[model samples]
Target: MKKFVALWLAATCSLALFSQGKPTTKPMYLSYGPTDGKNIIKFNLLGAAIRNYAFYGERMLSRKVSLILGCNFMPRGGVPYLENFTDDETLKTLEVGTFSFTPELRFYLASGYGGGFYIGPYYRFERFSLYQLSTTFDADEEEHTIDLDGSLKTHSGGIVLGCQWLVGSRKNIVLDWSILGIHGGISSGNFNGLTQETISPQDQEEIKEDIEDALDIPIIKSEVTVNDHSAHVKIKGPWAFIRGSFSIGYRF
Candidate 1:
């Protein structure tokens, strides 16, 4: 009996020790910290260099998905890179202001939600305000100058192929590279030129031709009308744009 009791006690003690050594699984709750950041705010450095102000906010949705919202504004200023858009010297005098808003849904190929190679579908709305000064001829071949003011608006949607990486020891610095993005949509706007004196029919036609000649883009079309003292130009066309950016962000 004594021997049996001793063996039983030893077995019970062993079982208890084994239970203590084995780890019990506990439920884990995800919290925001250095390892896991849920939100990010980014600035477009390249855009700023071109006199464009752009910003973006991103939120992680899942292990492989996220959402982003971006905004950009360019104050009324001289057209940047005029040589690439047109060879017309009149366009060199053109000034414009631009504003755009974009929303995107991203799917990351790797495990990380906001960092890795990503492809996203995005929608954008953009508007441009145009201003220019031009000299035209009247019926008698006299010089007349006019100031034109107008706006153009476009809506487009496309896919964005990009990659993002987290660097630094704490992984708080982010680099986002957008490889290629293309979008197409319709655009329409009107420009009005006001002059102090009444406009003649011949001068109106000349003004119309001059304005149309300045827009060298093949996809765009314009219709012009003239009243007593003002000329109106209606612009309509299929508009397309490409997006590319290398943006820096802070994850928090």
Candidate 2:
């Protein structure tokens, strides 16, 4: 009876092990963000074509955390409607060039590598170079030309919330969309010498109202400082944008 009991016990243990079966690979293994690797890089297609040519890259700290960095370069070009103005020795059309840098810390809700809902704090810096803007006006049956020269720079920081979607599991394509973002920052302008006359308050108000209405938002938060030689501007209070991106990347 003892021998028979021992054999039965061994047989029961074997069957239990068989039923349990070998553990399948972790489900996260199939997921990139759910499972973590090393790095992924993407380029902003729209940004490249648009005014700012931008490129972005990401490094995974963990399955749920990552850091993002981006750089943008915009070639110097004349401002809109600049052609309407004339360029000469003292008066010339204004041109602007910009370079920007951005850094962000992102948290992924559920990761394979980097997709889904994310919220992060971002800091952005932009450098701009300004040129002269010249135009002609008629006064007293005579033509008069005016030139305005200035330089402007901007810096901003705020929270950004966005969503990412991945398609084609084997290929693993990534798409990112910034649903809504808000930021407030400061902008300043300086002129070596501005020889144009300032308009009256009524004219200023009319221009401001027209600009606000056209933009669908109130701009010109404050004319921080306006002196004979230079001026400072603030762009704050309410600012928002919807940003999106389409790019390909490698997950390792």
Using TM-score as the measure, the top candidate is: 1
Q: What is the per-residue lDDT of model 2 for residues 1-252, given as tens digits with 9 covering 90 to 100?
A: 999999999999999998889675334433454345456667666665656677778886776688989887778875544446644433335677778788988887765357778887888777777665443333346644444455556678877778776556543566777666565576655444332555445433543453344335355444333333222333334333334555555554
Per-residue lDDT of candidate 1, residues 105-173 (tens digit): 999997465778999999999999989855465644676767788899998988989899977765678
> Considering summed lDDT, which 10 consecutive residues are worst modelled in model 2?
224-233
Candidate 1 stretches greater than 4 Å from native: 1-36, 83-87, 133-135, 139-141, 215-221
TM-score of each: 0.81, 0.59
Off by over 4 Å in 2: 1-36, 79-94, 135-146, 169-172, 193-246
Error of 2 at 72 (Å): 1.3
Each model's lDDT: 0.83, 0.60
Could you tell me the lDDT of residue 157 within candidate 1? 87
- Output candidate 1 Cα RMSD: 5.7
